[model samples]
Target chain A: MLNFAPTQEQEEIRQLAQSLAMEQVRPQGRSAEQQGDISPALMKTLTQTGLTTPFPEEYGGSGVVEAVTYTLIAEELGFGDGALAMNIIGSLMGPLTVLLAGDKSQQQHYITPFSDASRGHLQRGSLGFAERTGGYYVTEISATIRTEGEQYILNGSKRDVIHGGQSSPRVVLVRLEGTSGTGGLCALMVPLDIAGARVSLDEGKLGLIAAPSAAYTFENAPVSATCMLGQPGGSGVLRAAALYNILRAGVACGTARAALDYAMDYARGRIAFGRPIVSYQGIAFMVAEMAMKLDAARLLTWRAATSWDRGTGCETLVQEGEAAQYQAIKIAKSATIDAIQILGGAGFIQDHPAEMWMRNAAAME
Target chain B: MIDFTLSELQQAARDYAHQVALEEMRPISLECDRTEKIPDSFMWNMQRRFWAGAAGQARTQAQEGEEKQDNILSILSQEEMAWGDAALSTAIPGPGLAAPPILSQGTPEQQAKFLGPYMDGQLHWGALALTEPGIGSDVAGMSTTAVLEGDEWVLNGHKHYITNGARSDLVVTFATIDKSLGREGIRPFVVPRGTPGFVVGRIEEKMGLRASQTAELIFENCRIPKDHLLSGRESSKKAGFKAAMGTLDATRPMVGALAVGIARAAHEKTCQWVQEELPKGFSVYKRREIELELDEMGQELEMARFLVWRAAWMADRRIPNSKEASMCKAYAGGLVMKVTSAGVRISAPGENSESRQFLQKWFRDAKVFDIFEGTAQIQRLVIARRLFPEVDIP
Candidate 1:
């Protein structure tokens, strides 16, 4: 078929997203950034929209199976506000993991809890794929999970955990001591209130400020063997990891598209040398390059999203993830720089959304 | 419905083209590159087989066929042919270089008469002569002019760097009747090779794709019937530029597809080397690093191919794909350069670097993909215009 048009459902979702972004999401983006925390009201809005917990019908949520639609929603919310988008959608890491490879019991516990919004609660969660061990790669996650009898002992700390300080469940990547590389990697569902688990004060850092983020440390935290996701080993971890990458790519694409759209609007009316700046090749070409890069990024993300939706296999996920992430980072950086350039002096000022986008884009990679 | 799957017929075309590229094209690719001459027998034979399959598919499928993805199929076919050799795809004796414009903007009578030589059972080439020495991407700012002299039009213009120009018997020449009218004044005219004052200049020497010779064309007050005007009337300022851009919009994906070819060749070569030729003595970590790099390469090429196919599909469906067209060309142009450079870097010191040597040639060949049919910069500018249409851009 080789078609790039969205399905009817996707189109309807995107249209809904557009209106919600313009009316609800975007207006509060700046204030949220300043507050350094997502307001409960905004979280309620997102949750009510079903974006916060879209899952299968049986899972007590919207049965939005298509990753493509998820990305569209991510982009819109991200465009509205990157931090809030992350706050709302980023919390999906725990539930997504459960659905991807979790056992029935694990799904009943962790996943069923997500549909809490419709049932009157508004809890949020996070998944930690990154740890700030300078020069360490994902394969070298320092967090370790050791087996002792029927319990898996979890140690080490996770850094840059979104909603880290919040009282919500999460999944952390841990090395299964005595094993190395990806084969040794394991994902376990750790309830936020588990004993011996410590949450640090919200850490302040570069960009994406509206979303609360920090570190978590577990001191000899022991969990029943049932806490582990998927089968015995190396099952759900890979799919979860791959989904994380695709989600990041999709979010990154959101900020990039937003930046480019804002810059194009600026270029159209901003005049220089007796005409709109866009008429000049220097500016026109820059905007053009930004659009081209954005398109490429979107295509890569959508391709990855579709593949993930298929749930074909881990190999497909890894392939699409690799494709999506590279372009996401590259385009995000390029788009922000160009968006700022197109605005000239005005871009550097906080009065415009471009600077905000630049800050949000930095947190992506 | 947001599908990336190629139809069954398209898959057949792709497989057939892949075989031709591997068999008919690859064996003569190096020799043709070395000699800087078109392999006529190979080009003609492959074109015959290619078109014969295309014709057969068209005839059988139009009656009670389910669905056809013509543009994407064409794009994939271009890619497969290019994989064997970038030259073979372009140098194939056909009206490829000219058909886009005629198909996009020509009147039925004009198309029949102007395209007859190439389409009507004749082994010939037709060219779209647009780029001039002074004006490259700025088609409207051209120095070429056409002044109607009663029933005849006297055309005066100079075009260089024309593909299939030297030997093309028919050319779709873009000349402005009034430069002040800017884009509107420019129009395409069908100029036969024997038209008085129409001269073929020197053929260009190149760094790569040597088998396809580029020609410089000189038209000094060349006269042709007024009816030779491609649109059957003097173009408004917008008409000429739009027509040319329309042509690029349709053809750029094929160009992008060609880039995918070069990238595929480089990617395959690198993969083959890393898999077959790399020393088995390497450590697990080293092997993993190579494996990751290979995975990245495959991902990049496939992503680029998706963009190309999407653009082609839009064109086939008559969707306004100006942004997409430029996006694919721009992305593929940059990506092919990256892939080929990687090909050269990784294929070296493997099995005596035989593939590495060819990869170096492919690298040189890949450079022009970004330069022609609108350089990467030009494509971006076009894309920008579509993205921000509020301001009229030159």
Candidate 2:
């Protein structure tokens, strides 16, 4: 009943991703960090591989793929450069959300463009849900939305929005008139060019600089009646929350894998007392720990993915989602810290990738 | 760095052990323990049914990296196997206590002669005859003697507390080849099943590890071919001691994992008991104490697991893991004893039935882990020597 083996095609994809990572992503890791932008060429190469479209072929993408396969790809990419992988894969969440919840027409119009190259549709979307609340938990919705007879106007600010630039399409979750707090919130999809939509790109962040983590301000933004996704009331917010959980899980896996690879390589090569530092029991013990945690985190993430792949109900998967996300973050934080520890003083410097990985891990925590 | 992932080979190992545990051992587990004996028929039945299947399985698989074998999977398999019966799992026809040296330092000829027969299930019993009555932790003080006589090596030693000692078809017997060299003079020789001078002494009445026989082995001028000298070189008298100690380096962690398995059984047993006994809302006070103990036990188990996996992983990678191996043994041995005793104490008086299950046996079984395979005291000495090379004065 439990067949955890990766399919042949999935393995092929993993090998392909690994090759791409070593040949393209790894060599440019330092440059990406120094330049504050993951090479656009690499992003295009990834997009061309249909990373932007790894779903059902009918939706203009490959047929549905397993979460393990997805994780394998993320791990390989992450092993190369976590910051770059985050920038590229972080953008895929919005489209995946639409693919999950949108009507067929919406998929054809909004989702398909990101997939088919010949269509030449410039579609970019970011989830706008995190508010400037007192705490990190996104439980409270302070943004407000007023419904008019034929149209609704939204007015609120979303903080920590990734890739929140004017060039991309936007989705915002605002508290509607009838719904208050969680129940009151609804998701509205709007183009970046829409009236009263202000996009502010954050110039700085503790980590993941390649993908701008910015803020979005919607000042009485006019939205059409059909612009509302799922239900008019709270369905949209719930969908966004669900999407965030999955994306965060993916992020955690990627970052942890990266940290593990970095730590392992450092342990194997760096010499202390005339042999590989890994030869020492203290260092070897930590390496063993990293391996254990990384594997457990991956399994948890895969389990969560499998749940979603099987179309598990929202209630059944939310806890699994939380577990997967929590483990990923925990693993990433711990692995990267150990990665730095393996490198000792060298890991503390900016010239080395371990410090950056550590930063990325901390940011996730 | 060693990565402790389950290689295909290790997965094969896990699958094999898991199947044998479920199909054969698990079915007869309680009966075997209750009888305090593994019948020759059942033991032979396992040799053919389980060991034959396991030994014949194809070894070819994808090698991921330097970490060749799956230590964790092996440990997991051992845990599963122990779940069936640790004594039986330990007695399985793979390594038994004696096979590590052959696996680690044996020549191809040595492997073919010793390890091959066991792998084929042609032989079921083997014992590492190291500890003597007088020398528990000190190998240098061992009174066992083996002297070169023309082409054959004459051996005389009395090894006690040897597991499967009474039944072993092949015994890796240790003796002092040169008394002047102290610990360096020790040598291990594979004295075959029916050697004339070697005698089976009384099997000790042990607290646990009941399914596996523990006996006293006496060797009086037990003679064997010169080739029986394991890892012994014509030029070096120190060969024997290194080989004997080296065996401990590899087998200690496996022994440690046995402790882990016992502790796991105890923890799992307590958890199952809590679920069965406690009311819906009436929380038991002892359960809170048990949970707190379990928390500490879990952390200790995790740390122990890491050490075992690390040493096993290193062995798979062909790296020396003497220090890590010692650490796991030292820590986990102590942990299992504490955890098992706590398990017995946790279910004290009328609340639980120790005799009904194997908790009492587990409590009895955990004591040997620390005492055997280089005692906790020996491990500490090894750790101290490794940590501070200057500690040992000339």
Judged by DockQ, which candidate is best?
1
Evaluated at residue B286, the lDDT of candidate 2 is 58
lDDT of each: 0.78, 0.68
Error of 2 at A342 (Å): 4.1
The alpha-carbon deviation from the true structure for residue B372 of candidate 1, after best TM-score superposition, in angstroms, is 1.7
**RMSD score of candidate 1 (Å):** 3.4
Model 2 C-alpha lDDT versus the unseen true structure:
0.68
Worst 10 residues of 2 chain A by lDDT: A132-141
Q: Model 2: residues >4 Å from true position, as ranges? A: A1-42, A49-52, A55-66, A100-104, A116-280, A291-328, A342-346, B1-79, B91-124, B128-151, B155-162, B172-189, B193-220, B225-271, B279-350, B353-394
* lDDT per residue (tens digit) for residues A111-182 in model 2: 666766654224455666567662223345677778778888877787766655632345666677655544
In the range B230-249, model 1's lDDT, one tens digit per residue, is 77433454677778888888
In angstroms, give how far residue B191 of model 2 lies from its true place.
Answer: 2.3
Candidate 1 lDDT, A178-257, residue by residue in tens: 76555666777776577888878665667888877877888899877877777645656776777677767777787788
State every prediction's TM-score relative to the real structure. Answer: 0.90, 0.61
